[model samples]
Target: MKVNYTGFQASEVSPYLEVHQALKAADHRNGKPDVLAYTSVARMNPYQALLYRSFPDHGFAVAPLLKPFELRDLMLHKSRASSITLHLHWVNWVLAGEPDAQRAQTKVSGILGRIDRFKQLGGKLVWTAHNVYPHDAAHLEAELALQQGIADRSDVIHTMAASTTAALAEYTNVDAQKVLVAPHPHYRGAYEDVTSRAEARAVLGIDDDETVFLVFGALKEYKGLLRTLEAFDQLLDQDPSGRYRLLVAGGADDHPDVQEFISRGLLHDRVLMEPSKIPGSKAQYFLRAADAGLVTYTRSLNSGAALLYQSFGLPVLATDTPVLRETLPPHTALFLDANAAVDEYAAQLKALRALARSTTQTDVLDGIAHLDPSAVSSTFAQDLRSRLGLRQH
Candidate 1:
């Protein structure tokens, strides 16, 4: 089938490069020559050097067919392809709030009209539910309407966590039968030339004895950054010996809540903050320097960060949510109640810190064994073929 993959940012933040590598490797082993192309905002540049290097011989190319607010024309052009796998991009914009309600309605109308036209051309629509809803959705009602529309039209819906199936149905009213539970692939061996934990810590100026709790990735309001800081502060006060340090590393959002936290002088020598985009080459420093990774998401259905932490052999301390509980086993991660008091969270952090110190490398490896990328890719390829009705060679 001629498949066009959309919503993939060919940047360091996205997991598309890893996913593409795994899928391509699977295809090579299976001797399948499926034509796969990705839609990007622009042509290849230095920013996509890592992705290009990884998949040099893989039959993947960047096709600049889609642009923002041009869904109708793009879909009409891409209708020649057998299918379009919508990842996580266009829907967010379509559902985003505009100051003029009429203008927003017009845009939605145009998108829906194009979707119908694409269907008329016998093109299949697939959506991967990366989140139950957009993390930064401004117009909830409009976004829901668009979600429901997409769910109604989609031939297949993919979700990383099985627990999110019910939430997906609840939010988008998608038919449960159409949903497929595919675990998010592990990012093993994705980053190149990773530095050792000791060396990374030395570069970051972190002490050998201090237990580091890292809150990595883009810093957003819903990531529970303030709550994490509060819990870490309490832990420091309770310990009094300065045994733990909180490292908040990631690009900061323009939201007032995050700005307010920064303006209050909350960041200091102990509470280290690296408010910048972490490149792929330097990502391992943050991941390796830490004793444990902190995923303090106030609200989320799935966490790529938790998987990343496990991939890097760091025990995870994540917020207690059904999706997280289902995705990460008790042995892999220790869960904290999102609604718990600061003291309670601090106590949990302390316990996790102790656990991290006691946990062995073998135990960490065993915990993350299920996230093997080869196995994940094989399953993903088989599922895709089955869903698309492609005959096995």
Candidate 2:
């Protein structure tokens, strides 16, 4: 049941299913690829799975997880396919996590050099601007250079939000001409939404009276858990009826505030914090049990969590970030000012509770019907193919 969020190969999964996937991948390996990916996607996230599902007929496989210097090795084995396209998702990999500015700059330069070599070898590159900048930035200068370099060399710069162009432009120059706006697809078919609130509540032992505000995803500091916990504590203090509850289920980072929140037993009754990655099968339980999804992100460029909540028909109580402005569907969200105080977020939480009570769940679910994966998958797949200069079948 315990996975390191990255390394855990829990027995909760079916070996037969994995082998089936592997067999399919093997088939793609033997055939010439129409579109091959080079991404550092973690084992936990379903974004990659949902994405590649767009190409059922075409031979699309994750080619490799090569490091910056190691990409040159791919030159030895060239695909004979007319289009040799590679999508490098999360370009921050080379520039992120290095604290030393000089080292970070060096890392960026080395990757840039590799990218130049890849271009020389006739490999078309498409860069997805997933984040404006890392929330926990250690070297801003290096990251800026990396972003600029990627934008310059990318045949297509795919962005999920139009606001991302402006947000990223604040730090690095973004070419509007090359930018393609492909909205983050919802998790409609990714997780089952068949579980009713009553069934889910009983499974989690949640009372029907409790106004559950669910916080799902990795328990990172930039996720604004401190402010969220503070705001939740404030709400509980004001309401003696004990009708409110906050359920935080995700893998925890080593943030001191979050660690304290995880350690404390005082608020266990009102605040249920599951400090681990929730498995895919169990995702429905959290989604169906909650009245509304809660997110108090301090800063972010993209929020898949918002889309996940929307996919499941749960309205979100979220910080009003530019990304969320473009991402959230109508009548499905209660926004708190991104620059607001903890007390203001608490007020929004209360407002969200009110909103959830007034609106029918069917109405909320209907709001996100347009976001079904089938709706966007074909468009996104086509845009990507066009950018890569691959002719549509």
Candidate 3:
């Protein structure tokens, strides 16, 4: 069976690749299906995945849409595979942040148009609902309407989180039978096999004495960076001479409030910003060197950041939220109320600082070992096989 994954190419470093790789390996081992991941011409250009075209496992099936209209004539004349399942990852930019009516209408229309075309071509459709988009109050109506349209046309609606599944059902008025809950792929990285804390610290340029609090990934509003900073301020008050420093490794995209807070001395030298994207290897080093990983996301269905932290054997201090709790073990993580006042934040911070010192000996390594890529691959292969009605050994 040839399964073509639509939206975003597989070569780039993304969570989607993790999923694709897992499924691919599982399918190969179990003899479940032959996967042909479809991607756009733009992604396959010499400037992109084409550079890696020699690598057969990269999964670069040329997508017809991105080609020039005249050039598409060539693709049309070629022998096309008729029996293929089209899995479209529901990806419309800005669907979750601030929903503009015009954009929402356009995005929905575009998605529906694509779905209609795939249907006409006799392709089985699976729309994975990664997000409903426009997470705020303003976009609620528009998002619901768009979701309804998607649900009506989609043969199967996929969701990684139960909360996301429920939202889809409620917004689309889709029957519970149509929604399929599946585990998103676990991260596979070189960081999993790392040795010592000293080596990890040396790689990231931090002293052995510093108690590092790591906040990884791009700064987003709901990620709770503001709350974490406020909490850090409180933490500092309790331990004025503390050696703890925050290492924030991510690309910054014009976060004015975060800058203002830094300038106002609220964060001071405690906040160390690496205002660039660190590649996969270095990211692992930073996490391993940290005393505790911080994730204060206010509203989240799931987090890849939390998984990365756990993969590197670093415990997390997250906000008291369902998503974080579900992803991490309660005993291994520290949680504080998302709406805590400054005083409350300070107390929690103080406690967290102390806890980090006392619990340094805790064996979190064993816990991280469970999120294995091979295990995740096997699980995903079995699920996809079951859904597609294919026999697997």
Residue 164 in candidate 3, Cα distance off native in Å = 4.2
Error of 3 at 112 (Å): 1.1
Candidate 2 residue runs with Cα over 4 Å from true position: 1-33, 56-69, 77-79, 95-99, 192-194, 265-267
lDDT of 3: 0.55
Residue pair clashes in candidate 3? 95-133, 95-134, 96-133, 96-134
What overall lDDT goes with each candidate model? 0.65, 0.73, 0.55
Residues 226-291, model 3: lDDT tens digits:
677777777777787877777787755556755653444333667776756666556656777788
**lDDT string, candidate 2, 273-347, tens digits:** 678989988889988899899776877778889888877777888778778877786577888876789788888
Pairs that collide in candidate 1 are none
Highest TM-score, which number? Answer: 2
Sort every candidate by TM-score, greatest first: 2, 1, 3
The lDDT-based order of candidates, best leading, equals 2, 1, 3
Candidate 3 lowest-lDDT run of ten: 66-75
lDDT tens digits, residues 232-340, model 1? 7788888879578887777788998787655542545577677878877887888888888988777777887887777787888888888888877677579888787
Give me the runs in candidate 3 sitting further than 4 Å from their true place. 1-82, 94-100, 132-144, 161-164, 167-174, 188-196, 202-205, 258-267, 358-362, 390-393
TM-scores for all candidates?
Answer: 0.82, 0.87, 0.72
